[model samples]
Target: MASDLSPASRRRMQLALLLTPVSLFFAVFFLGPLAIMIATSFLAPGLYGGVEWVFYPHNYGRILGFADPAFEDFDPVYISIFLRSLKIAAFTVIATLLVCYPAAFCIARLSERSKNFCLFLITLPFFASLIVRLFIWVLILRQTGIVNEMLLATGVIDRPLELIYTDGAIVLGMVYIFIPFMFMPVYASVEKLDWTLVRASLDLGAGPIRTFLRIILPLTSPGIAGGAIIVFIPALGNFVVPAVLGGAKVMMLGNLIEQQFLSARNWPFGSALAMMVMSVMLVMLFVYVIATGRRGADVTN
Candidate 1:
């Protein structure tokens, strides 16, 4: 019904129209903030607050364990913090995989309705705020919490167990928070698994362990990799679980970033910390891609 515009022109125009919103969104929300953060990282710390216009690489040096000129010795605190964050993140990934594999497998084997229900229950926590759910755990783990009261009533212990505000509780909170991320991906892979291979391996006199290690494991490797990456990245940067559960005793990379910005009033240093986190996240994302690509290649071979 329209004008003398050529078909090609109309198609190009339609394509541009479709892409406009997403392109604008990416430019405005993602790239703009990223550019600012990177630029901020290079700026010197302001005399009192924020950042000065002067270029400075010292912020990164500080995080990398170099001492400022005033100090005689190098400070390794930030380096240790980064290492601790990685360790916790790695452990959480392993733990999540261990817990999710069996649970995902069970769900995969269920009747369709039951599988749907189980998956729904697994994801039901999303309906509530994460902080609220974490606080619920706090209630159950505190000295006067449900667990302690139950143990007391049963005469299992005379005193309450120390459950909250510890590394163990922080780990528990992180695991609980991120388990669904691990489970959903693994469940998808398990649901799509070819059980014929498992049966065939068993028939060929390969034991359960051997069959799993050989055939079954390789097939679902992609899902496990995806889940692990998903869990690890967020866990690495997590501040909330450690804050609420571990209290002042625990701090992760996210907390470090938060502290620099909010408490220390060190914008340049905070920006540097943030950019490091973004870089680490990018590396993890690349690893996820490569690992999944190799798994796909192996499957093809």
Candidate 2:
């Protein structure tokens, strides 16, 4: 093919050849696993807790409450768990955005050296294991932890607050872990912001709040949307945070899926639940892309 092509065409062929390995890698590692999971979802669970060769729609039915008559009453439990997961994920996204925006703005306004240093510091935690980071949180938020002792010393409370093993702790853990996702996109946008336009808005007698609302917010919306997507997707499917910090009292979709697979040995039901979570994430990603595309077009216009 290279021998038959012009120089430009040869170069293009070479580039395509180079990308083949990466494409094959993704197909094997990512697409292959997803395909297997989806296929397993459509099959029946065997007596020995594996998938049988038999095909059945029973798993989907179980998830949607079309299974047995007795299972009809349990539909509300699944719905409630899904709704609760959504609420927690939404709260995590909001909290991450709120905290990260100001930090990103400040970093974006800094000198290049300072910006890099700060970014390095913010990402330093990633060098450690995620489980270790979570354990650190447990040490901090536990009833007899340093945080409680510090509060007591400062006379902030008469008793140690129930800081750990609660929904509030789960939210706090999620926000802490996911803040970098929100920060990076917002920082990218803010770093590219035109301060001159802001000055011009001020010179044209627009108030600071109005300038921010009309100019800055609109221009930075794509970044916000990207961050929200990054934060919300993982939070919706989080298991470790809810299990460790929330004391297993608040069961998110991820935990339920784990239970189905591990404890109940119901692989088909777990696959169905996993597919449902994936479906929701795909829908969210689609909406986010459309919104960001429209915002980008508006900015250009």
Candidate 3:
């Protein structure tokens, strides 16, 4: 009976079968949750802790500064947290790039075996539990931690340095966790780089700095941008790193969202805060798409 059909019909049936599982998985896991969240974002918060079915745009108004006068007053802290999260995420990208870019070039120039070993070492941190790794940093940064103990023995100062629970500490933790994320992309770009162009630039009387800026930088920019996007997006919404390293003194957008949901019990407001994060991610994706499209067009020309 099946053999009676044309090849095109059979092919279409196969394609549909292949797509069915993926489509169902995405619809069930991704789209389902996203639809629920979007719906909840517009709904009012219940008196206790859950959501109310009624539409309430005030959830967003609370973030944008137009909350219902009777329920709650507007606060700028949400905006501040959003901005601070952006700043920290930007710093994390820069730091991760700085740490990975040079190392990528170094690895790219190494023997295949050595390069593989180094890559393995770079990824070895992932083998450990993230919480355990973060706790190691906490132990090293705390007042009675190793640094302080060593400094005290050397008599560097009477008091331990304030290292943990700061913005810098948060950035440091993010950089540590995101190094592998940034490195692999940059390494791929560097590994594929045309060294002959660099040599040609030098032979054409361009200085080292000029040759690098003109030849090497543009060629590897795609990887850098890729790494930056991956690093920045997750870093923006990272709560665990900040919670561990930043403490209560330093709160980011992720922490704010966590508090609204878990502590404050404002489900609508929490959903609103999550929507803000989703909005930022969408904007970043849009920018990346535009930049990628332009780069492709330039190459074609």
Q: lDDT for every model?
A: 0.87, 0.86, 0.92
Off by over 4 Å in 3: 1-22, 69-72
Clashing pairs in 3: none
Worst 10 residues of 2 by lDDT: 65-74
lDDT (10s digit) by residue, model 1, range 45-129: 8878878898888888888888466653688899888998888888889888999998888889889899889999999875779
Report how far off residue 295 is in candidate 1 (Å). Answer: 2.7
Candidate number achieving the greatest lDDT relative to the actual structure: 3
lDDT accuracy of residue 78 in candidate 2: 74
lDDT-based ranking, best first? Answer: 3, 1, 2
**How are the candidates ranked when ordered by TM-score, highest leading?**
1, 3, 2
Residues 153-214, model 3: lDDT tens digits: 99997899999999999999999889999999999999999999999999999999999899
Expressed as tens digits, the lDDT of each residue in 1-301 for candidate 2 is 6486799988988899999999999999999999989988888888778879888777877766566454345456776788889999999998888998888889888898998999998888767688878888999999999899999999999899999988788999999888778888888888888889999999999999999999898768778988888889999989999988988678999999999888889788789889988998899999998887786688699
Candidate 3: deviation at residue 143, Å?
A: 0.9
Judged by whole-model lDDT over C-alpha atoms, candidate 1 comes out at 0.87
TM values, all candidates: 0.92, 0.86, 0.92
